[model samples]
Target: MYRYLEQRLAVRIMEFLRQRYPETALPAVVIEQPPKVALGDFAIPLFPFAKPLRSAPLKIAESIRSEIGSIEGIAEFRVAPPGYLNVRIDRAWLALAQALARDHVPKEEATSGKILVEHTSINPNKAAHIGHLRNAVLGDTFVRLLRYAGREVDVQNYIDNTGVQVADVVVGFTHLVKKSRPEIDVLAREPRFDYYCWDLYARVSQWYAQDKQNLQARSETLHAIEAGNNETAAVAETIASAVLRRHLETMERLDIEYDFLPRESEILHLHFWDAAFTKLKSAGVLTYENDGKNKGCWVMRRAGTGKSEGQQAEQALVQESGGERVLEEEDQKVIVRSNGTVGYVGKDIAYHMWKFGLLGQDFGYRKFYRYPNQHECWISAIEGEKHHPHFGGVAEVYNVIDARQSEAQSTVIEALRELGHNEAADHYTHFSYEMVALTPRCAAELGYALSEEDKTRPYVEVSGRKGFGVKADDLIDQLIVSAKSEVDSRHPELGDEERRSIARQIAVGALRYFMLKYTKQSVIAFDFKDALSFEGETGPYAQYAVVRANGIFNKAALDADEFARNVANKIPAEEFSQFLNGEATDEIWELWLSSSKTSYVVNQCIATTEPAYLAKHAFQLAQLFNAFYHRHPILSEPNEKRKQFLLATVAVVRRELTRTLAVMGITVPPVM
Candidate 1:
């Protein structure tokens, strides 16, 4: 309702302004909420138009207030101090419309084409850690927000099967563990293969530190895997595919789903990089560096440096420091090393080109994994099934990568622009976010041996190479155990299976909400106690509110939908208006007002590319509903009309809260 009225009023005021001042160029009309509800529902400032109209802001506000006769949902317009125009909504009309679940907002026009979201592109080498969870949850929730806002979206999880990370694991099995291809294949088929690899990867890192010569094995293994059709490549594939499956299963515990899994091996086997290389060379996007440490390598200017600008800067450096000091100026990124192996950024550029449908080549698709609901997740292949869903060719693409990859992501976008795919470059979005760290208490609870210095720090950063991080599956299992104990102590009457199911819901909710409650730029310090707490701003708290709302209907033996129908049919608009306008019922009206802003809050979240806003909205809504729940008694009240009105309030709060949590990928269990 707030969004609808805001949009309506903005359009009406804009049209009025253009007619009033025909020669003046008008600015965008922005609608904001007043600080206090008593002031008005919407606030618009006329300061922006003062210079254009050659009039004082106060005079402009008065002119708008007097001439802008009436807006549909607005009851009165007042000229506040300075240049503000405040609008009071028709409270009774809004209350009645909301009670009936009637939305007067017009449908938004659909975006031009499909939006491809790439996230959770973890290296297929080890078990996913807490850092990976933050990436996946943020990406998954953003996808949900886009879908909720009526956009066509495709979710992708890129598999780096041929990267150095996988090569290290391959080295660990072959060299450190002395396992053959057959032995590794057998081990990959066993349970907890990713966990085994996790430890082996850490061992390999230590092995390299012991002797620098041991690093040669990693290079050789990486080359063999990229060349494919060999024993080493087969072993890498077996391990990567198995670990990738484990990753999907872990994410599935949180109800995260993907539509495609594009593998790097397929990118090599299908000649994606080769095709992209041809385009880059033809467009002069790549240059051969003949000297100064990058001899024999093909390079490109870094993201913000254009070709001419780079040349001018290098010339200036040469003039200032002479030719001998030129080696110190490192302004170019090597696309192909002197050894002729393509860098990660090169392949990433090719992959992004494919994402935007600019790469004429396509990948072969085959079904790789299936969820319990039978939603098949497809993967790229050399020779795939004949009939498969089209995977690429999107109008826009968003890569949910970590902030550390900002440079590489920017290079990809710059390459697109240089190649003259300007529109595609403009639509490219790098959803960068900071990493997650464990609080000292959380690290201690995970049984890690923390040094005294580490314990005193605010957060303890985990290193995958050191095998010092909490695995995703391990964390999920622990959360479920904690939640189950809480459930057992509180609801012993429920059966074991039912209690376990509810516990799973609560655990997943807590984990996902903890991941999403912070802004993308804010680093999350994961703590088990804070996430599971039921009294404060946590997922279980919101879940408990929904549960309590449900209990109200359960005890009264009344259907929530039927109660809403009763309010809409039995109560008069004037009576609801009087009830809503009464000073004694301000808190009740505030609950309804908060409930009405779910869509408004969703739009805010989408516009900002941040799910934290929605998380805050859900928490605030829960707080308001809890306050209303305690202050007003529904079933025990003797006033029939007031009781029904109260029930109607509960029904709306329950529905909106449930929907909001679902958008964050959090579920409200029947017994939280």
Candidate 2:
């Protein structure tokens, strides 16, 4: 309702300006909130109009104030000094209209196409870490925001089942542990098999470092796995599939799910790279470099970097003698090596082509996993079910990768443009974010061996190759234990099962909200003390606000939803306006005002691809409601009309907070 009124007012103001100045070119209508509600609900500067109208800004402000007459939902307009048009909302009409609307759920905007979000592409070799959690949470939150705005979305997790990481893990079980296929299968059935592999993966890295001969096995294992159906391939597939299941479980604890899992093994078996390679050659996207350091390689020009003048002249002379020569190796990205092995970017190009439906091929699909909610997740296969849901061919794509992969991501986009899929390239989004590390205090708490140098730094980086990182599940378990200790103390009378459930909710909320409260570009140093606190700017703070609001109704023996339903008919317009406009009721008015911006903040979040804005808005709303709760005691008040107004304010805040937390993937339990 707030968004509708704002847009409607902007359109009216534009019309008024056009009629008042027939010969002048008009500017876009810009509306911004005033610094304080006491000043005005919205402010529009007339400075831009001054030049166009050939008049002073103060004069234009007065003229717009006089000409823009009688806009709905606007009580009055004022011309402030220094050329500003401050508009006050019609409190009586707006309060009643918003109360009658109940929750102000906006209608979906007209979106034209489906959006594909691929995230949490964890290597299927070991357990997930805190860094991967940041990626999954960001992607999942964005998906929820898109769905709330009524977009068609498909969530995908690309599995690198045939990559070198998985190959090394296979070498571990087969060569180091001397485990047979049946023995490995038994291990997979055991609990925390991914954690076992995580340790073995580090051991494998160490073994290779000890002897140069062990590295040969890694290369051979990678080749066999890529070839498929050999013993090496079978072992790699089992480890990758089991580890993939573990990753899904870790993500599900935070309420994140996917629609599909596209594996690189399927890309190899189905010959997707072969199809993409043909088109690349035909379009000259990849050229053979027969000389220089990249000799006998197929390479694509790097984005935004050009050859030096001397190198270009040398390349021209060399090309006359030999085809495609004299290019700097660093200036080109190798797509196919001299040994006829396709690079990671080569396969990624094909995968993205399939995403935009530009490839003339499709992956065979089968239902591989199902969630508790009964939503089936599909996986790529060589042969599969005939009646399966279609997986790819989306109009837009967002790949949630870390900032370290910027070069590879840019190469994929360049390939798309080179192949004439300009629109797909334009629509493609590399949802890049920085990595997550552990704070010095957190690292010490994890029992990690931090040197004195590390202790002096703000954070300690973790490496999977060295088995130094905290596993995602381990961190989640520790958080639950911590939360359970707090919950047991606060609610000792509650049953064991109920307390455990509440602790899980609080733990998950703390983890997800902590990951979301910062911008994508900000690197978070995870710490428990900051995330678990219930007092300020934490998930528990917001959840506690909702619980307190619920307690108000529980004590008063009133139904919040019922009171909200009857509020429009019960409170007269004059009375509603009087309570809001009264100077004495400033605190309650602030709460009401904060609750109205949920939709506005959501729109801002989607436009900016920044979930931190919405997180901050939720925190601010909780702060305002807490202030209101202390200032006004609704049940103890003598004036019934004023009590009803305060009750309605609580109702709206509860609804908005509930909705905001839901979108953030944070759940509010029955009793927080």
Candidate 3:
């Protein structure tokens, strides 16, 4: 409703300006909310009109205020000194209209193309760590926000099943432990197989360091996995499939799910790279070098390059700079190596082209896993079901990879543009974020020894190869334990199952909010203490506000819907308007204004591609509700109309906060 009003007001302001200043060119009128409710419900600066109107902003504002007179739902307009039109809303009218709204409020639909969001592309080798959670949580929250805004979305999780990471784990089981394929399969069936691989992966890393010749086994394992049709390949597939299942389970605990899991193995077996290779060669995007360091390899001209120092020096000798100075082999990135094996980047380019449905190919689909909700998640296969949900051909793609892959991401975009798919390149988003590290205190709490230098620093980086990071499941379990202690201390009379359920809700809320509270570019130094706190700007704090509001309705023996239905016909117009417009009621009015701006905040979040704004808005809404709860005692108030109005305020806040939390992927417990 607030979103609708903002647009309506803008139209009136623009119409009035065009009529009043016929000869002058006008800019788009910008509507802004004032910092305080006392100032205004909305503010528009007159400075944009100053020079065009040939008048001071103050004079222009006053003139416009006089001309745009008596708009409905507007109480009054005041001209501030330096050129601002502050418009106060008709508080009584807005309050009554919103209160009497039906059970369901329709959202303004968003007009956008099908959006493909690829995130949580964890390697299928070991347990997911704290860093992977940041990526998954951020991507999942954004997906929720997009769906809430009425966009068609497809969620994908890319699995690097045939990558070097998986090969290393295979090396450990095959060469180091000297285990046969059947033995490795037995080990994989044991509980926490991913955890076992985590330790084994570290041992393999150390074994390679001990002697370079030990690395030969890794090369053999990788080649077998890539080539297929061998025991080494069979072992790799068994281990990768098991580890991928563990990764999915870890993410499901946080309520994250995906529509597709695209595997590199299928990408190789289904000839996706071959199709992409033909396109690249036909378009002259890949060059075959015959006599240089890259002899016999096919490479692409790397994006974001400048002349080398030696080339720049030679170019100065000629009047016209020599064209590219006989391009160095080092200047190109190898798409296919001298050994005829495709590189990782080459496979990624093919994957992205498939994402945009430009490769003229598609994967054979197979149902891979099922969520607790019984929704089937599909995986790519060479031979599979005859009928399934179509996976690709998206109009917009967001790859939620980390910032370190900026160069590789750019290369893929450049590949798209070089293929004459300019629109696809333009629509592609690299959605990059920085890494997550643990605070020094957190590292110590997890029993990781820290050097003095580490203690002095703000955060300690984790190394998966060294087996020195917190597993995603481990972190979640620890959070549940911490939250459970709090829940049990506070509600000992509750049954064990109920208490555990509430604790799990609080734990997930804390973890997801902690991941989202920071901007994407900001490096997160996660700390358990900060995340689980109920008194600060954490998930629990926002959720507590909703719980408090629910308690009020329960104690009064009346729900918000019942009170809203009864209020309109019982209270006199004068009495309701006085309660809303009186000077003493300004703080209460602020809560109403904040609750109504949910749509406004959603628009801002989508425009900026930032979820942090939504997080901050939710925290502010919660804060406002807490203040209102303390300042105005609804149940204890004697006046019937005043009590009803206060309860209505609680109802609005509760609804908005619940919606906000849902978008953030945070669940509120019934008795938190």
Which candidate has the top score in lDDT? 1
lDDT of 3 by residue, 1-672 (tens): 677678889999999988877888998999998877778888999898888888898998898788888887788999887889999988877776666653222444555579999999999899999899999998998898888778899999999999889999999998888898788889888768999999999999999999999989888889899999998899999999999999998999999999999999999999999999999999998999886678899998787766678866765664255544344544688889998889999999999999999999999999999998999999999887999999889999998999999988988898899999999999999889999988999899889899999999999888889888889988899889888999999899999999999999998988888888999999888777776565689899999999999899888887766776666666666766888886788888887777777777777787677888889989999998988888878888998877877787888788888889999999888787
Task: Estimate, for each residue in 9-31, the C-alpha lDDT of model 2 and write its tens digit.
Answer: 89888988888778888898889
What's the TM-score of each model vs. the native?
0.95, 0.94, 0.93
Across 1-672, the per-residue lDDT of candidate 1 in tens digits comes to 778888889999999999999899988997888887777778998889889999988888888889989777688888998789888888778888888877654655454689999999999999999899999999999999988778899999999999899999999998999998888888988878999999999999999999999999999999899999999998999999999999999999999999999999888888888999999999999998777788988898888655477877877877777773353336688999888878889999899889988889899999999999999999999999999999888998988999989998899999999999999999999999998888999889879999999999999888898898889998899889999999999999999999999999999888888899899999778776676565578888899999999999989998876777567887788878877885677677777888888888888887778889998989988999989888877899998887777788898888889989999999988876
Q: What is the lDDT of residue 163 in candidate 2?
A: 87
**lDDT against true structure, model 2:** 0.87
lDDT of 2 at 302: 88
List candidate 1 stretches off by more than 4 Å.
54-56, 104-108, 306-329, 440-457
Separately for all candidates shown, the number of backbone clashes (residues 3 or more apart, or on different chains) is 0, 0, 0
For candidate 2, the per-residue lDDT at 62 reads 84
**What C-alpha RMSD separates each model from the true structure?**
2.4, 2.9, 2.9
Q: What is the C-alpha local distance difference test score of each model?
A: 0.88, 0.87, 0.87
In candidate 3 the C-alpha lDDT for residue 599 amounts to 73
- Candidate 1 vs candidate 2: the lDDT winner is 1
